[model samples]
Target: MTQVQTLDRTGTDAVAKAWTHVRGNLRRSAGQRLFDQWLKPVVLVDGSTESAVRLGLPSSFMTQWVKNHYSERLLLEFRAVLPEVVSVTLETLSDEPQRVLKAEVEAPAMVPPPASAERPSFDPRFSFQRFVVDSTNRVAFNAAKAMAMPGVPQFSPLYLHAGTGQGKTHLMHAIGQTFLAANPGATAIYVTGERFMFEFVQALRSRDTHAFKTRLRSVDLLMIDDLQFIGGKDATQEEFFHTVNEFMSAGKRLVIAADRAPQALEGFEPRLAGRLGSGLVADIRPAELELRRAIVARKLEDMPAVDMPAEVVDLLAARITANVRELEGALNRLVAYANLSNETITVDFAVNTLGEVLRSAQRRITIDEIQRAVSSHFELKQLDLISERRAVAIARPRQIAMYLAKRLTTRSLPEIGRKFGGRDHSTVIHAVRRIEDLRAKDVEIDGAVRALMRTLEG
Candidate 1:
């Protein structure tokens, strides 16, 4: 073979070996679902040169995502295999068939692509400036801002936990972006708990464990979101604990997000949970009606031309309480539908378009809210309703609260009983039964209970 041909063959052989290791590592690093969906479809192209390797993905979207999220790691992996390698890029594969043996990828655990003049790792929409802060999430919002600001990290390993779409991940992203802006050139790594576990496992499989540790620890800031995924994962948790210790010891800041507070992370290592709680633990409560309304208005502001009726805005804000993400989605769907129809949006239109969302949102109400609503409707203090007062004035409202708590909220009998001044499950059952019979026989009691139900439901 000529020298050029010989060089090509050598490069091809190195890449082939690199691909085998990279693929295995990537499979472990990215979960099987992500690997199969995004990475697995990528094929090494025929025109791939030695210094600049090209990975061809199935679609433009996949190509862009891989380039954004995985290109840095791929470049590092390629350099390890071929010392002369300088760049790794992802391109959309052609529909026509090609020779199939090129399955390997130059793979390392993803180092997020270098940030552009504009933030790269974080979604522009998820910045602190755009986040709609209200009483529900103000503490978490402030804590996140503090973590992002330059200076001593007031709280290392700051843990922010909340239900889905309540902005926990958004806070992490904001912290990362702000941290980078405050301390330019500082390294920040943002990953999910599943991704962390996958990458650690991949490193172990590929015997690249040291590189994994170095890559993770070398970072100045590490943010892990959705940590509940690694709860019972022993080995992953072991590596995570060590990573946490090393970062804390070095005074590097860590930001973590989960679905529950540290104490509620039942299966997680107790020590790890305790360590997470050692830093600031901020809870983001479910957004209230006023906040939800404000979010709807802000979402509408994004499309200034779109006409969202006052009633429709009120409908969405009042109905969609599950999370800001879902709330946003419902609005998006409504606007898209409205534009398609070229008609005015109405409460009726919104109800029809988002009937399922409205139903789901209804289920978001808490037992506390139910109790408060019943107490308010009867013009009795909330404490009187839950206290041991046996007077008809308090007892009637108390029974109605218990009835609504059972009927509306998903709390169990025992749980609902505990909320009502330590009453037993039997008392809750009796209250529910008494209310049901009263609704049938007594007109005044029936009207009052029905009014309370309508008030709470609305």
Candidate 2:
């Protein structure tokens, strides 16, 4: 018996034919177990592009599993039947309800949007005109603005580090937007360090690394937020270091933002740290009173109809000194509460709405909590982590625990010593110095210390 062949089609028709062929082949050639476990959840989301087939998986595990066991086989079969397809791209569907809601709300507005026209580039709301540049953040803002100019390499990496809500992300985004506006066709990517690590790992595992390098290298500007998250991932760090080198060699701009300076980042490789520090480093300080007031005014512009008493604004500016996010959150609450209750906004209302968040931010975490968090992360018993057991494994973790406890907590050396199996105050000091020295000399040690600090702080 002879089988009939189907005629080759063009464009969307061709994509549909190719997808059907690939799916039918997988169902027949692969066992029921593999099909159900790995291939069942995969859906053909986009087939408009002739050269690529976009598939959506349910989760990261499924994506990894399919890529590991069946990616090559599936590609081979698909190519044999339809040679036009070049690659398969897998993405996981986001599960968050809020994301779904946000997408639904925004989808209608985005339909038929102009392709070449970008969204009002700089978040017109977040300009230097509105940014509260205090003494602490003034230098960093100026440096960032200078770096954003055309034909300037004032700072190659341009590392911006500070605690949460200290405007690192804001500055980095502003810089990217500024550059793109000034130099048309100057592309930039602003990604969190976690996303960078995720893409690096996925590319490495799938062996489509050339594509990865091209995606990162082809951009004229790269801005990474929360650089600390990638500190301990060796493979990601290696890939990122190469990307940094390529960008720097080409005189392309690189901007990195983290919660702490490169010298203070624990688990980051020394070589990576050295490269980061080679350029200008700016530390954004905590928001001052005037800066806080400016932030409030900027936020109020969003709700122009809502009236806030001047005294209430002053009280909030004076009281909420932690970060910009917190300050704005407080203002949001105050506005919401006042609007709902139909009451005049006052100092008393502001106090009531913002009391808990402010107090919590001011609440100091104790040394014991830091010790416990560090111990739990390393899988050592809390007692073992705090004990002076001089075993290489236990000692290193113990010393790191001590160092974090001292730095993150407000406890004195002697007080921290008492908590750590009653060691002498000098012993506590010694442990801190030892960890610091090791961190400075050894990249591996630095990575561990950084990992421990993140756990403790969290």
Candidate 3:
């Protein structure tokens, strides 16, 4: 009878209270990074019965992640809190069934009518002011700014390429915002390759492609992102080639971004690749340790309450070498967990709190990877680096390879030297020193080294 009275209490209230307690327990036990990333967003759905519990997540991917990792744990936690709870079910907060995550799919694209006065809003957080710039992305940053200027840009088709989360999209958004501000009456349109193909197909189906072409070409500044996705779409490529011609011929500004250089795009026509590369092709290199630290500091400025220590900052920057997004994510996770647990931010706290994340971010780059990247960059055979050639053409690339090996790998100098033709530790040291000095004084060498590092690290 007492248990019946307990069950008589509104199921919503009882379940909500139990959910809150279970979440707190999970947070404390699962560690901050994993809890916040996967379980924090979970909500108790309204379909719970006396024996079964339903939990809702925003998407299928998250549902799957949590279900795979914490289903049994969740069931145990709920049953511990409420003896009547017999089962836990995780589901997406949607009517649709779970779908497999796949590559970017083409869909009907929406371009604002040329006659429409309304403008698309740019993400306020991604403005140029928020961008952290250094040697790695300075050229692309400057070129993006130049494209946004009032008059015709110095470069007609500014092509920007970088690995994911490397600020290519940030630069594109900044360009759109700046261009609109500089020319109040001008029109700017941003679309991804998938969207471009989608809109084109929609136009084809509706037999209204003239409007599509007009809407796209009539814009004053047109920016395309994820251009790699459009490869092998011939009909879409034909229209795109014309769009590029229209902009170039009309002197309108065009900016494009992809994950790789134009020359490396697979299944792309040579002419389209050439057209995209005809203008200034700038690459956003991977963030160096200094730049990464600066980014962490800049991010912290936004969270004034989170007083992260300097060593923790250094450890994060050094360990999370993957990309800017992960680096910032690590910092945010650390700050959030510390706040939740009321723990002071320290190097040890960061390490323990972000153990899983720190390990995953530490991608071990090998000397073989570095050598391959350098050899490809210098157009030398892979063995040429480890061979006995002393020609400046081969020797300089070999030195660069040795320098990269020492800097990028955990291997000792002797191990690195051994990889590079069994040279002595002194030889490896000299190469490292020479490259370091050249990186300071010689722009070309510095640029080459930066490119190589970006390739390897990215």
Candidate 4:
């Protein structure tokens, strides 16, 4: 019997050594379904650290699938068998495969790239010019534009808050693109809070946290979407706080977006909430009928041939009053239906196609539901949250609940006041003012109110 060497020597010695034994194990395990589908596609591009291995995947779908289903298992196996890989990252392979792989191999040795320097993959269709300004989000849109002007510090971290499908993400990207255009060399990064957390965890596991910090802190502008998801993670929050401080101290811009206000982010640390609230916070209210109609018209500009009746558009604008995402979805469905049926888009056809979504949007939220959410968030009895107690804690929370009820529901001041221990309507007015003042002046108070609002809205 002749013995044969299985591994090939390569110019990148580190990568070769790291994969010498792992490739054999993987080959043996290839029969497994998951190993074939998720793991087999990932090729080790380089080993920058003794504990971190870079992997290249063919597509984003495969990268996400592997990350979602098998990242931990892959990491564990690599760590146990290779003894060199502390973590494994699945990066999408670029069209220029060799160039991307070379960059990955050399990245660890070079100074970490600036966070803002990483150009975001923004959708050109979503720009300030294209976004229809209406009563619902005009203030937010104007504020974002003002903040985007070169050398302006009107709001360091403009927090855009609203329910999902509202154009918060669109606004953030628009600001980034606008800022870059104004300041040619200006750097900006657009990442979801979830991506921030994911990158932070990856850094921690690989013991390359210093590089991560350097990259993030070097950014001139950092925009985080869906920041409410940053709740419940102590380590990530700590890292984020320092990053925020560094950027703010250096007069760099930070923009964050969330489905609800800062106070509504349960499980988030108080200090993190305070930092987030320390700048201008604007809420993008749900779209009104006119705004929805404008959005439909603007979207239809791209598909002029797919015409719909005025009544159909009016019905959609009036009936499907959800967020912009739903609005776009309805239009997409109508266009597709028309193309398939070879029929002109009509009011009846639009109604039948989008009946379910329209009906769902019309679902009503009650004052009672708001009261219960408020009570739970404040850790008080349902009656306590609504009672006219003058104690600082109870009174403030009660006022916030009343404010939410007034703003979110169609309840009259007198009706809301009656629900809250039959207090006078004037009391409701006072509570609303108090909360509004606090929101404008006190960061902590603003965060708390926002958090409570999210609970109620949910």
Candidate 5:
């Protein structure tokens, strides 16, 4: 009995020492940025045995991400340090036991299961019911819903483009979920660009490329998010081009999303870009002020217990205009800290708790900056904007500059007029009204304004 006790202690010490060595290996191999974001949070859970090791992450999402990307690497690292270490499992760091994401006994065979196997499940929170529609994303939302409905796809590859944290992934997940619900036996898969590349590389190393192709081609619906990550990967691009062709030929639903339009994707093959843009291409603009306010109110409605003041709501909606994720994160932080401290959810309390976030959110753009951005975008000289020329080329750009100045800056109408070659305040008003009306009817003008606003705000 004493011998067994000593052996157990020795094993525990060995595992602890092995974990330290493994962490160093991971940091050096994964690089600094990837390590800090995903791997740094992993902790060796208590009660791990010699043959079975447990790793914990803060959230299920992080756990899944780490599992998908680093699980095999982690297991190999542990075994190299301590040969007895047989497995490394990932789970959320909660009191309740999470679904254990088990690494394979060896490396995963890049081969996927048969077509009859269960389809991948999407996040329940990202259903169509949860998505909020507005003028900015209504077209994309409607297209997603239409694709998910039963019958033939109206468009082969529905392309969704937007900035980060904007609703691309959400809509993709919603489409997968709704489609699967409507067609219970249908198969669907959602993979990030990075994950697809990782799997493809693994298959190449294993000499099992056929299995990978079959797995993807057999799916009824395929949605790939963040296609920008696979940039410059020549082999992956070749495989992706073929995959796109297969989907189009089969009339299967193929959805892709990226930070920019297909034509704007750098290092991508021209043929691939042209094929991707051959179908319906929809862009989700940044949420306007009204939509942001509505989002805040919608979030508040979910938390009935938290008595957030109207002033606080307005403050959050108006200030945090970067993305919906950041906006919602600020609100969550305020609510969580207030709950922990048993403090009243007042405007003053919110201001104090979210000082750094609010400070970063306050980006004060000037009229001069707007004029320069607009002039540069329109290929007009700065002098042309302030000149008396009324040509369509010059006058239209000037009106756009005035409209942006009004929307992005806090200057009064008279102040804006004084800066624009001493025009009357009425001219500025007409420009604002005319641009506003044009945005509703003219896609090109709206796209230009959205692009200018994003550039100037940054």
Candidate 6:
């Protein structure tokens, strides 16, 4: 008994340090909102002299939720911090005599048997800290941060839209997580479009419509993702419409995200569509090359021991231009293979490992896009660069943008000139030539051009 007690004490300290490291990473990886909800209650239950580790949660529900979504990553983080550790387990901690036996034996029988939840779950990995912000996503990111502030949100029903994998879901999750952290005990629910539909249908079928409505509307924070799918569901829409009104009317924070803007959602009721746009509407543009590189760096921060070559990361950032999710997946695949097989991830290895992803992610930049990129960089409107204004702010940026268009896109000088408010081909040539000369001479312009090039190319 003495030896067992001593071992437990020693193991507790070791596990505490390990869990601290793991928790930080988990909070960063999962998102603050989710970590607070699901993981904040967890503590070490299996602190033994053996290599295996176990975690105890307050309920079987939390245990199973983390097990399904975070088991692999949790184990990875554990092993990363404690090389001696080989296994990680999660069990419910409760006063029941059976609960003690359950943690000591296998798991809580209460773990939901389903592979996926019918309801959306908050992931701690989706917090604002984990979100890689840049020119493309800055507006949306800022808007999300603002909405997450304490007290009634200055804006209600913040609407975020982006193409798939572009962090619409991330922001939605981030807002919920951040808002919850600021206001503890705040009831926040995250529901996906399909999951919300299924849950609503089940409620109607089970004759539990009142309970469902009460549960969904009672939350202080309600976040709905992928609002585009709510289009075809007339019944669901009616309920969801009321849910929105309930939240808004009560001054509860409500955030809705979709692939398209409210107006662009086909078949959406006119009133609902109008209501969606009544609040802040922030759009996440496609990620820039620099942003992708930064995201890749952020993703690989978890694998400090992995000898991920710079060229390989650059290759992934440059090639995997689809969205953040796919980019992270590609990085994860390469890192996992390298870590498991003890092989260094090189440029060649990355190329071979992610051929299919690269093919699908191939996106060519256009001259118009170049103009937009340059205009965005200079904080000037796209029209400012194209207009006949000869101010230094407009003309210099115009020339630099033309130079970028000539270099980045395969557009002819005449075509490029036509793009820049229909100037002659010689004007485009002079602009390109003059900018080329200035790039070497003017440090500011040179820096601007180089930064723009990296943004476009990467």
How accurate locally is residue 334 in candidate 4, as Cα lDDT from 0 to 100? 82
**All candidates in order of TM-score, best leading:** 5, 1, 6, 3, 4, 2
- Candidate 4 lDDT tens digits, 55-154: 7677888888778855654665566555656677777776652432232333232333324445443455568999999767988999899878888577
Which candidate leads the pack in lDDT?
A: 5
Q: Estimate each model's TM-score.
A: 0.62, 0.55, 0.60, 0.59, 0.63, 0.60
Query: For this target, which candidate reaches the highest TM-score against the unseen true structure?
Result: 5
Off by over 4 Å in 4: 1-116, 364-458
Tens digit of lDDT per residue, candidate 5, span 68-182? 7878668867876667777898877765543432223212222333554435545565778878889899999999999999999999899999998889988998998899889
- Backbone clash total for model 1 is 5
Clashes of each: 5, 5, 0, 5, 0, 7
- What are the Cα lDDT values of the candidates? 0.77, 0.71, 0.80, 0.72, 0.81, 0.75
The lDDT of model 1 is 0.77
- Residue-level lDDT tens digits of model 2 in 116-172: 222122333345556677677989999889888999677688899999988887787
What lDDT does model 2 reach?
Answer: 0.71
What are the candidates' C-alpha RMSDs?
A: 13.6, 18.6, 13.9, 16.3, 11.8, 11.0
Count residue pairs with overlapping backbones in model 4. 5
Clashing pairs in 6: 29-125, 30-123, 30-124, 30-125, 31-124, 31-125, 33-177
What is the per-residue lDDT of model 6 for residues 162-214, given as tens digits with 9 covering 90 to 100? 99899998788778778767777566667677768876786788687875776
RMSD of 2: 18.6
lDDT of 1 by residue, 131-218 (tens): 8998779999999998898877787888999999999988887887788878886777778888798878877887878867876777
Give candidate 1's root-mean-square deviation (CA, Å).
Answer: 13.6
Cand. 5 TM to true fold: 0.63
lDDT of 3 by residue, 176-288 (tens): 88988888888777778876887688779868788677667777888899999988999899899999999999998999999999999998999999998999999998889
Which pairs in model 2 have colliding backbones? 266-446, 266-450, 267-446, 267-447, 267-450
**In model 5, which runs have C-alpha deviations exceeding 4 angstroms?**
1-113, 365-458
